[model samples]
Target: MRENTRIDWHARVEQALARVFASLDEPLAWQTLAGELHASPWHFHRCFRQLTGETVKQCLRRLRLERAAFQAAHGEARITDIALEAGFETLEAFLKAFRRAHGISPGGVRKLGAWAGTIAAPSNLHYAPGEPRKHFFIADKGDAHMDVKITTLSPLKLVCYRNFGEYWNLPGTWQKLFELMASQGVAMPAPTGMTVFHDHFDEVPMPDKRSDAAVYVPQDIELVEGLFRYETPGGLYAVKPHFGSCEEIGTTWDKWREEWLPTSGWQLDKTRPSLEWYQGHFDFAPPELHVTLLCDAVCRA
Candidate 1:
């Protein structure tokens, strides 16, 4: 059954790639690509990346520049016309991107009669003969049994306490936020709590990591001194229910990033923050706890 699932995923991804290449002259939409594979946009994105080693956006941009480079090297047509045909909005934008990728201007390429060879040639899933399959599977670490879905979330107004520092210190911040909320008389029946991570640890220093411990509350709730209101931007997310000790949740995230993400055809949506959705009570000690991790998946400009 696992093998069959893997095969189906690969076939669907290949089909989606074909569709994307067919319409290279136009703007590519995640929704359209997801629909083609009958998969969620986040899932499709991860899978595409896993199969191709490039995000959909990256693949499209590379293909366009390669086409433009070819024209610049071998054709006499005006650069503006070629840029427009390659889906660039303007000649200037095309030249900037081309120079960045190839280390040479279109005019330089034409005059020199050769491309700088810095930019790799465009490639598709169907490689030349003797090429090996790029996708591979990792040993399932029970996370494969976890259910994941791409969902659109409505904007949520949160009563929050912000924290800045190392991630391990977040628990203390949560305690402070909870105390502040209680003191402010901002209480909710069956309250849903979340911890929002605002910075990627890999991209930022430990001292710069920012997190917020928040709870959904009435929109009109007045803020107390240390507490403030935050509106989580509504967009698509990939959510997974986690059942484990809060401390072990980081392991699950690692599994997703190292094991699942590469093959999932999705990339982390860095524009928006990721959050930990608290479903119910969690005993920090032993056994395991049930919570949900909401990861940003929508790509925005």
Candidate 2:
């Protein structure tokens, strides 16, 4: 892993705390846990703040509160009992934390009458791909047909590379493509399909493609040295043209999943990972340019 100024002791501490919180049935006191990590309470507290942006107690408290809400929303137990189980001494404290974490009160949760059915509701995984549907953003509906046209595309053959290791500090994979072309004697294009592929649920977002990114390349090009390859199997994509800083492209994803897909006569096709097509200048890439994001949708055959 490339060492950066950002690495600190508290990160390790936070990770340990997360593990402890998840397995809280067999609990350990602060000092005992501190001894296990071989750090003084004062030092651990300081490092926790520096790394997690929250104090140790607050971190544990927050995790407990989240657990309490989860349990209350799922377990067949009283709110007060669930609150105590999560380490909240008072129901009031649990209520406050619950509201903050879920944007709803404990009482509201009970009144909803179906904890198993609600509470951040589990996403449905379908056996087959979703159907294709056209979505458009009109500049002006008042304008004539000349102003707009819609086109459909068949499945695409997407060549890709998986990033691994400490990918954050490294330069964009675009450079890797340049080198790949040099070695293989193939021409490359200004990228039309560039995306960071997150295959699992990890909350903290990082620049390292090792954590994400299953980038696509031209079909004819051979895999270059130091780069691994894959294909985003051809499928229907609920393509959207998102123009923004690359870091902010996630907003488009949120909008798509929450606002659009839910009612758009289409369910997510999980076969191919979503693709991000760059839309702005390639001159000064990384941390500076705007881009487009496409949420790939595998269509029902």
- Candidate 1: RMSD to truth: 18.1
Cα lDDT of all candidates, in order?
0.66, 0.48
lDDT of 1 by residue, 118-178 (tens): 2332122321123443332222324354467778888888878888875655667787877
Ten contiguous residues with the weakest lDDT in model 1: 120-129
Instruction: Report RMSD (Å) for each prediction in the order shown.
Output: 18.1, 19.9
Error of 2 at 80 (Å): 36
**CA error at residue 246 for candidate 2, angstroms:** 0.7
Q: Kindly report which residue pairs in candidate 1 clash with one another.
A: 45-265, 45-266, 46-264, 46-265, 46-266, 47-264, 47-265, 47-266, 48-265, 244-289
Quote model 1's TM-score.
0.49
Which of the numbered candidates is closest to the native, going by highest TM-score? 1
Q: Residue 122, candidate 2: how far off, in angstroms?
A: 29
TM-score per candidate, chains pooled: 0.49, 0.38
